[model samples]
Target: MSRVTPTTSRSIGQHTHDYAYYRTVLANHALPAAFIDLDHFAMNLERLRQRAGNLPIRLVTKSVRSVEMIRRILAAGSFMQGLLCYSAGEAAWLASQGFDDIVVAYPSVEPTDIRAVATQLRYGRAITLMVDSIEQVMKISRIAQAEDVVIPLAIDLDMSSAFPFIHFGVHRSPIHDETTALILARKIAEQPGVALQGLMGYEGQIAGLMDDVPGEPVKSAVIRHLKKKSIVEVNARRQAVVDALRKDGHTLRFVNGGGTGSFESTRQDRSVTELAAGSGLYAPTLFDHYRAFKVLPAAGFALPVTRVPKAGVVTCSGGGYIASGPMGKNRLPLPWLPAGCRLLANEAAGEVQTPVQHALSTSPATGDPILFRHAKAGELCERFNELLLIQDGQIIDTVRTYRGEGKSFF
Candidate 1:
């Protein structure tokens, strides 16, 4: 694996000190507000490109949840090629905004969404749908035929490893072997209105799992071993599948793989044409444990201290913004900034109030702002309508999230 050099000049300690800066900028604004630091966001974008080397990046829209932010990343340059939308309806919505070269990363069973995508295809938009079964292919084929347009399709391959007693990845895509992939490709090729366009395989165990977690050294070591072996196996399987499809006379336009955590390793694979990433842009708390690269904390929210529960504890209003994943303490929002503050064990991150205990020399006063980082990136947008854009200690812009635009496609 190639070594990744740290790019940011500021350390975690420096970032904590910037709490004063955030307070100063948002002094006149309301509490329980979310913001993005453009300087850190730009730094992270550059680092993602560097890790990708020469390969193109497909921005994952689900991790951003903002059309304006997506447009900004695409306008950055040619390094970003297209979007990997999570929902078929969202893909059509982005298409209506004049963005092309989109691929729905998940399968859709909704007839209305299928018709919407077909309409975009008829209007000369480059949108591809994902399928792992022939049933989904036939559904899309019927819609394409009815609309009198040829829709593009991509195959989703399962890249997880099955050990004797352990399954080491996400449960997605039943098509694993090369034979299964070739059979599906042939089936799509025989269809009248749909054509094979791409292949997508996501190795979530290697890409999403953290290898440098703090407490469990033995568990972290085991996870690292599993990731190393999974990488080699997945690459070989992906290559074989691609070769089989080509031998069967199917020409695939693109092969997408990887995520924010696996960019360095995934880019080295010869079979993958493009890599998908987006969570790294926000640098949430869950992404901080990776050893390959260090990302800045670009996104966070501030809540107001409403009361002093005790000498060492301060209660803030409205914090319980937990992240989506397997249940654990890691999914809770982290009490960042003001350096040494911590969440109380008895009542950690409540819906109406959160009590924080600290050992700093100065105690938190009523009406003071306390900053925190969410466990995941775009999920923060679900709680707030808009994100205040901060740059160099000033609010430059306020942009709407998907929720703010009255759009929610789950």
Candidate 2:
């Protein structure tokens, strides 16, 4: 694990004042509540739009688990074209909500879920399924045939770099070469009740990897070099794949690529018709290390101090909401507001009680609120039922999370 130093500095007094504001506004609320600063969230959204330029952005639903929040983003502007859902169930639910142009970004193997999507397709809803294997296509085709509808499909291309003993990106999508993509296109063309609609290649190496890690200058340089090489190599390969598919008479509706971290680089590829972004809207802790762009911390949760375990140590009520990824300190939630407070290295964050050590000068009494930023975006919503929407130091509205709405697709 590489050490990450804060790229931007904030004064301790500033954090103190920010926490004071939150405490004052949510004085009546319960502990362990999540909040989103609408002002900061809007700023982050504008940053994403600027980085995307003229290219369309597909909102990633997994990064934002709230339907209300997704609606707010789509209503914000026409730049957001569609949704990249994480599951077939989520896509069907979104379609039922009158959301058109949804693409299930992951392959669905379950016959029930495929039948659900096929039902939506029979109703003339624009929902596309993602596939990287012939087995997946066969499954979808069987469901489509059963439902008596033509299902749309998108080929998920593996954009990871292949070295002698090193793989640079995530292990997703078995289709890596243009020949494989063309073969899949031909397969789809010949298969009954299925049509190729798009091509998706997520360059997670350039999009998710941090290139400006602190205390590891050599590692950072290597990451930057790899990213530069990946940009050129991925662009050439992706273009070739699109070209081959086009020559095979497959008219792709969209070529999706990029993420929040690699927005600028991914959009530069002429083959990618649009980019996908969602985590940037909330600007979680994992997005902090990107050097190309900086986003404001928009979403956070506040836990009430329940005990003064020892001098200079305050224990919060509940805070064991860790983000998903390789186990590391970076995956732990960060103590943000009331700065100078640090998580105890020995215990870290706990499920019931999280003991935080503060500077000797700042003494926080019991019942005071402690603000924290989750390592990821939508994962924070999973911990709380509702997110208290805040703007200008006041709670405006409360929206239900996916869990609160009685829907847990994962």
Candidate 3:
């Protein structure tokens, strides 16, 4: 497969035509009813690869739930680095699949998952467990010691705007400030069995926030301001904590930061050794709002047009698959192509059908494909059993998601 580039309005039309052919082929082959354009996916990956430059991107498995797709991308180029997993079970599963470098993004509360991490670590897998508090440390340590296992660990620092108030981003990690982060780092460093490998800071406001959109200018401005403040304050404070840890004789191996959206800015920071990226693999509608760079709409779901009540409204079968974030119309699946199509006010995305309002020049007949891209990437895969990999407007192969593989790690 050749490297694909980012799509514009011109190329997107061609992609649509290509998708029609791909889906038709799949239908003829008796395959499951889902499609993924590999050409677009490859282009999306390359777009991220070019944007990231020299910095290696840790594939966010949560964004791309298909293990085979992850493997396929990893095989694409060496620029792709390690897996940034969401769950401990995912890390363990990836480790079993011969993935050496794996970092569990969130702290694992499940004892069974922790034990699995310990087992993977015991067998010489480079799996890093993310910890935020001493309580978290104690919890994992107890399980580790009980299993007589020694493992590597990374401290998760809460990278959010903390100027006048704690009013931005997700309230994830407790280690936001230098003092608190250093204290936790010290505790982890003192732990005999576990090794403090590095620090992981996720700037969600800068990385995940949508900077561009048609309306909501004031909200977008606020998000941009928060992101600017966060980059300056968080970077300084995070560096301070790393310095403090080193000053106290801690040898930090790596400092991980950023996501797919903020790769360029994060890579400029000398403090961050490696940047995290996963969502770019399948550029969702939420990511479409960014102004800095453009990525291809790699992943999408086609729900069959099941209900058409009026000349202006057409409802599709099974489209209630919404992404987890602030709920609004933006969270709903966007109707791509044949422009002027929008989601209905009463029912945004229904369980069985989503009514869309559009001025179709030629009234769309029943069974006409309504391609909808979710606001977020991997979350969409969870709703589907398999992804149809399309190459050059053709269905080349079909791959199973974690759901299809019977591994619900989440």
Candidate 4:
């Protein structure tokens, strides 16, 4: 099932029909239900492949919570290798489900999750724990009976910025200095049973920012500048860190970097062997901000209009599917179909009955479907048990989410 690259900007018309199908399928279910359009989802997946050029993509499960969807996308190509999981519990769950190479992208503080991951190492599931400090190493080692029994690990270097007052990214990974990175990599190398496999540095500031968007010019300039600076600075530093670590006598199995927005740029960096991407598959709202690519809105959540506040105002139940990030206008969900709607300021998104102001007011009556795009994807999918798989504008089948499977590793 190789990804079929789109040759034009037009959407696969199946999405429109998929919308109708879900209206009927989730009719009995609660309002404000969220789901993915498999057709568009597939297209987005293929688009990533086209954009990736020759580099392999590691699916980020945190961006798409549906395990079935994850497996389905991986089935599309052998090119989609491994997963950049967010939690140790999720890593263990994904591993048990038969995914061998799972990288817990962020450093974990949960002793229970760490122990759960350690328990899976006995089954030959190769889980890579991310470390930036010796404390993290000590924490994982203390949970397990022996450090040697712990699964292999990778080092996460902070690639945000080099110069003070010119910060260009997210504040992550304490191993920012090449000297510190080398020392820590050496320490991990010395630890028993823990193999120092790779290094990961995510440039969220550039990869995640939506520069070159039509309206936000000033902000766009800053983003573009920061991105260019971050790439040059981070790439050099990351390579230096890798070089220094190797000089200290460490074997680098892999050096993972990049995100959905950074596939091309990250691939351009000779030091980064493989990059991770998950949000691009589903084309979450956050990805809409990227200047490099335009992924179709594959995943969307539908909220049923339950109230007619006014002739112009239609309200849907439980609109509270806000994305987790800096709180602002962008954190709120975007109005998708039946345009001309805006989220209420005080209550950007509501728990139930989210009022919308759209020109297509006549188009939607009580019980009519109004599609809402989450500012971020997957997080909304967690609220739903199953996603209606729509193909060629029809409901092909329904698949269970990780939540529907009764798995909540988060």
Please tell me which predicted candidate would have the highest lDDT against the true structure.
1
Q: Tell me the whole-model lDDT of each prediction, alpha carbons only.
A: 0.88, 0.87, 0.79, 0.77
RMSD each, Å: 3.8, 5.2, 3.0, 2.9
Candidate 1 segments whose C-alpha is farther than 4 A from its true place: 1-17
- 213 in model 1: Cα distance from truth in Å? 1.3
Q: Which rank order by lDDT, best down to worst?
A: 1, 2, 3, 4
Q: How do the predictions measure up, each by TM-score?
A: 0.95, 0.95, 0.92, 0.91
Q: Model 3, 126-151: lDDT tens per residue?
A: 98889988988888878878878776
Worst 10 residues of 2 by lDDT: 1-10
CA error at residue 66 for candidate 2, angstroms: 0.2
List, in order, the clash count of every candidate structure.
0, 0, 2, 10
How much is the lDDT of residue 214 in candidate 1? 89
Superposition TM-score, candidate 1 onto the true structure: 0.95
- Candidate 1 vs candidate 4: the lDDT winner is 1
lDDT of 2 at 27: 94
Model 4 clashing residue pairs (backbone): 14-393, 148-192, 148-193, 210-289, 316-353, 316-354, 317-353, 318-351, 318-352, 318-353
What TM-score would candidate 3 get against the native?
Answer: 0.92
